[model samples]
Target: MSNLNLSFACWDYDRIQALTNGTVQAKGIDLNWLNMPVEETFWRMMRHQEFDISELSLSSYLIAKDRGYPNFTAIPVFMSRFFRHSGIYINKHSGIEEAVDLKGKRVGIPEYQLTACLWIRGILHHDYGVHPSEMNWYTGGQEAPGRVEKIKLTLPPDINIQPINDEQTLNQMLESGDIDALIAPRAPSCFLNGSPHVQRLFPDYVSVEKDYYERTGIFPIMHVVAIKDEILEEHPWVATNLYQAFVEAKQKVYDGFNQTAALKVTLPWFVSEWENTRQLMGEDFWPYGLEKNRKTLEAAVTYSYNQGMIKNRLNMEDLFAQSTLEAYTL
Candidate 1:
């Protein structure tokens, strides 16, 4: 039988380097790997089904699945995981000294349904006394003009979300103090450019993130690997094949962390950092399968549902291919 040829679109992260460099091969398949910006890749795949497999935003994927878009099915491969507390930026003059101070203020977001924003909101509401209904939300592009939410949202009646004018970006509003705060995956240009007025809501974000993770056991999933529904239906074996390849590809990156003879990484404390991270997050810090990530996945599903991104509370099992749910141990 001829190997199935497929196009796979994703960011060229170090962990997935093996897949892009052709060192890791998907079993019984020939992959055309395309390295591109995540937004372009997601837009092309969601709007036109441009690739047979692609990395998709977790929140957008849930919204798409709930709305019956019928384009893709996700796998347990979480390509991006992040702690979003540090993503919340506040105006120093807004009088918001803490997360609780965010109440009754106007906040800006790139989109209401962005996975990073969802996690931020969830943390704010759950950990602190602040609720989504307590503040007004403004949505638009962060640094660029005219970005829109890819999926429609059905926010709670008490919640308020307004879109900014096409002429203005969230960065301008944040810097000018038009918005009290902003929650976005990428820092707005004002903060990145060293504006004294722009600062993280949680100045001690590292400690806060560590405390939150220790309490909740969630590393917050940002993106998942999705396969075209049509391709998946016709070629069921492709799911497991791709999953295994991704696992091996990520393993190659993990193995490089311990290479200390000549310093595998440029950082002087690369090995020390790795050891400290392992101590804090465990040996398999960035696990990819269903079993290891069930708690985090469940929290994300709950957050998505609570935030009105999904019509139904979905079980994590229903989101991924059944064949890839469990590993075949040796």
Candidate 2:
């Protein structure tokens, strides 16, 4: 029989470049890679289930699963992970000199349920004693107006979330001192443009993030690979196959980084940076698989539950395909 054909939508990342470029292929399947911006992929997938497999927001996926609305299941292939400390932008005039100062402040977010914002909120609450209920929240597009949450939310009474006016964007609000700070995966335009009004909450976020990882071992996960439930029901083996393929593709990236004849990446100090990262985080720094990421995953679930994003605190095993929970040893 011919191999199964499926559409997989995700952003083009170096780790998965092999699969996108046909250097790696999933066994028993022919993937039709759809290279799309993460925001578009997430919106379309969450709203319409438009692809066979897609990169999904971890926070939004949990919300959907909790609501029992989407027929989707995930594998352990985390497509995007980041340290969210750098994403927290603040107005210089907002009097928010530290994370603790965020209490009682007005904070803007691209969306209430964004994975990046979820991690930021969780870290702030857990580490800095700043609860979500302590501050007011405004949600809208970071650079454009009219952006809204992909899935509707009915948060608890304590969480104060509101939408900005259709005519206003979070970037403008932050620059004009209309909002105190912004938490998002992407930097606001004003901060990028070096507007005197905007700055990162943690100016030395690199050091802060490293310290966080050393202490907590939680390198926040932002996106996961999700497959349609219908496909899983039809081809149960697809999960393991896809998971293995993603692992192989990621290994290719690791192998490329080991080459020192000439820098595989464009960074002038790529070798030193790679060595420093390996020394800090170990050989497989950007790790895949459920077992390798359990602590981080558990933290995310706990955050989701405490923040009222999910009705129940889901068990870590329930979040991934059962087949993906283990791998065969050679």
Candidate 3:
């Protein structure tokens, strides 16, 4: 088997450390991964289709599907149970204790894309009964001008957004009570949990989130992996080999913390949200089980579709090769 290049997302060190391992080296699989920003990764993929396989965001996947990209399917890997995608951060001194407290308050965010802001607002309005736009919303951040002619053609026009220039200034603004809430994705972010200015607004993570989404058709995206259909048709062995390698690597990292020596290697990689990694999965979470992954993926697709980000419903079959999980050891 030839070396496979995996284009992946910016997961703050924890997930990165888990997936890059000896199993991948032993398999002769080279993960030539490009570390790009969360949103740009998809834009780059759409433009060049450079990587052999990679993780994709749903917005990117929808754009790809609409553009007639072939043979791409999402194999469910991780189930992000928390409000993992879009976080609501309030000033630590603001006395904001819950998600509902942000009502009629000003908020600052980096970008206003289809997936991130849209779903956040949909949940706020449909589920929580708070209108996000009515809140004094600020969308700031400089976008790298689109260079690819074709990709630019496919994307919607920019929405007058200018991302805040400096993290310090944003921090100061939050400290000064200029922005009531800070909304953005994690990693390279001033987010709720990690940001000193903000505290976790909600106590019950999973229950509150599930309740919100069940009432409103909005759910946060964890992450997704996709392979080009052309590559699968041309090289069938790639699926089994790569999937097994990832499965092994994922388990190896998970199992490492249980051992004293391996804990030395893995302790630094544990992010706050990922401290529950071992607890996140039950005793039977390893071996790439299809049942749990399938349930998570189907739920995600249903929510994204219902919210109109997916344009139409996508099934497990449309998005993945179901039998491929069988190829991967549980």
Candidate 4:
């Protein structure tokens, strides 16, 4: 049988590098992989459907599915997972001493519906009784000006969301104390360049994240692998084939991290770090299937629904291809 030719787009993360380098390949498929920044990848996929398969923002994917707009179907392969506590930066002069202090404060965000912000907002509400409607939201680009939300949003009446002035960026606003805090996937430039005024809301973010994970078991999923629905319909087998290929690719990265002979990567404590992670997160720490990630998925769905990004709550069966939901074992 001849292999089907398909285009896939994603960032050049080490786990997915094997697929890009031809070490791991989907069975009966010839993949044209494009390594690009995540923003451009998601923008191209969401705006033009440029690729047959690509990594998409989890929040945007849920929005697309809820509205039945994009003709795409997702798999259980989560391309990105991040704990977002470290992503929140605050102005040192602001009186925001704790999560509860965010109430009535002004916060800047790159986009209101970003997955990281959604997770942070949900965490604040659940942990500190600070709801989304409690704070004023300003949205714009972090570094440059004139960024807009990728998807349309119809939020609740009480929610305060406004765009920043064209003259300023979120980072500038954060540094000037125009906004009390900022929540984003990447730290603002002011925070990155050691501006004395900008610091993480939780200075001890590592400990907070570890304790939060222990309490909730949610390592917040950020992105998911999606395929055009037409492609899935034309070749149903492509679903499981691609899923298995991604699993194999991730295993290669794991194996490299665990090699004890010499450091495979640049990190001096690579093996020790791997051992510590294994003890905390178990052997297959970064799992890619539905069952192993049910709690995480459920939390994301609830957050999206609560934040008004998705009109309805969706389940795993609704979001992922059925063929890739479970793996057979010996």
Candidate 5:
């Protein structure tokens, strides 16, 4: 078979790199990983007509879809979940011990409009009965500007999440007991546990989710996968192969492959780092089955619509080109 030239945006996002490993490589589809920062990656993908298969975040997906990159599809490779949101942390000495305790105090978040952060708000208001709008919020998310807007979502009408960004200021405020609690997606700095701090709040789901996750190695939700349109038209089989590779590799990780076996295919990814990253991630972190990712894509579109992130409403059938996945299923 002839080699396929595919455009994949950077490898900094851990899971994207993992997915691109043996899966895409084995199909004679070499990766053109965009080696820039996240913002630059988006712009590069936007300007370059050459992107055959790009790895993008859900927000980035919306942006690309708006700009008319007809081939963009959320592939059915569900490899992440709500773990990357605003984590809720309080000072060790601060008397505020629960999610509800931060009523009229300041909260620090990495960024605004992040999906995981949205999940955090939903959990806080819907699950824990905390009104997000009433509390003061300070954001310290990525310096890359558009990301914050994407992260600052409006929930339940009255709940308007305000944002403030400045890493040093947020850190100083949180440490000085100025911010009563910190609500943000997981950051290396705020991790009391390897996962998000709020996992402590969801007693019922955490254990059940953990047990089932350990049993099946399932990730509950995430941005799913898709092939670039031109590649789907020109080399449909390779796209299907890419999808199959992820499914197979996921099984391989769950089934227990020693260093030599995985490394031969995985190349530079150390088994320890690879294994640890998987263990540190929550069970819902990889929750996409072949058909399930389509559901995630559906949920994502619904969310983008509700959030007013996009002007055009994209149906699943319209957004995803299923020729490759359909053919593979047969």
Candidate 6:
């Protein structure tokens, strides 16, 4: 039988290099890998369902499914995860020395519904009693102007969110102290360029993030791999095949980290860092399947519902393909 050809759009990550470079192949499928920046891929896929499969925002996917958009369904493969503490930037003159000071402050975000911001808000609310409704929100592009939410949202009345002027960007707003803080996946250029005005809310974010993980066991998932519903309806087996391929691709990266003869990554302390991570997070640190990630998944669902991104708290199982929920044991 001929292999099925499908278009897949995602960012280039070391974990998925095998699949993108054709070293790992999905069973009965041929991937036309479309490597692109995450923002473009997300905008095209969310607005138009442009790809057969793509990496999707976890919060956006939940919102779409809850609203019955019917364009996509996801497998349990998480394409991106990060600790968002480092993403929160604050202006020096804002008088915001801590997370609680964000209450009643003017905070900027690239979008209210971004998965990273969702996690940030949830973490602040839960860990420090700073609720989403406490602050006034400005939304626009981080570096460019006129950016808008990819998915439509009907947030509760208490959450005050507004778009910045079309001519302005969040990075500029944050740098000039027009907004007291910005929460985003990427650090603003102001912070990257070492502007005296911009700084991370948690400057020692590595230590803070480590403490957070030790306390809560959540590594905050940002993105999931989704297949168009049309493709899934036609070939249900595609879900399992793609899921297995992703697992294999990820494992290859994991194995590469152990090659001590020569460093697999460029860092001088790559092996030591890898060992420290394993000591802290265990062997299968970046796991793909559902059961291994239930706590984090459930937390994300809760955050989405509490922040009004979704109408109800979705069951964790409802977020992924049934076929990808289990694996064959040897």
Candidate 3: count the clashes.
Answer: 8
**lDDT by residue for model 6 (110-139), tens:** 989999999999999999999999999999
Can you write out model 2's per-residue Cα lDDT over 1-330, one digit (the tens) per residue? 899999999998998898888899999999998998999999999999999999999999988878777889999888999999999999999999999999999999989999998999999998899999999999988888999989888888998889999999999999999999999999887888889989999999999999999999888899999999999999999999999999999999999999999999988999999999999999988888888898999898899889888999888788888888866222
lDDT, each prediction: 0.89, 0.91, 0.53, 0.90, 0.53, 0.92
lDDT of 5 by residue, 144-261 (tens): 2223443223345544455554335454555566666665544434344343322223335446445543553433353444466666666656656776666666655544434455
TM-score, every prediction: 0.97, 0.98, 0.65, 0.98, 0.63, 0.98
* Deviation (Å) of 246 in candidate 6: 0.8
Give stretches of model 4 more than 4 Å off: 326-330
In candidate 1 the C-alpha lDDT for residue 222 amounts to: 96
Q: What is the lDDT of candidate 4?
A: 0.90
Per-residue alpha-carbon lDDT of model 1 for 52-167, expressed as tens digits?
89999998888887787847998889989999999999999999999899999999998888889989989998999788889999999888889987766678899988999989
In model 2, the clashing pairs are: none
Cα-lDDT of candidate 2 = 0.91
Q: What C-alpha lDDT, on a 0 to 100 scale, does residue 67 get in candidate 5?
A: 52
Question: What's every prediction's RMSD, in angstroms?
Answer: 1.3, 1.1, 6.2, 1.2, 6.6, 1.2
| Segments in model 1 whose C-alpha atoms lie over 4 Å from true places | 326-330
Local distance difference test, candidate 1: 0.89
Q: Model 6 scores what on Cα lDDT?
A: 0.92
How many steric clashes between backbone atoms does each model show? Answer: 0, 0, 8, 0, 24, 0
RMSD of 1: 1.3
RMSD of 2: 1.1
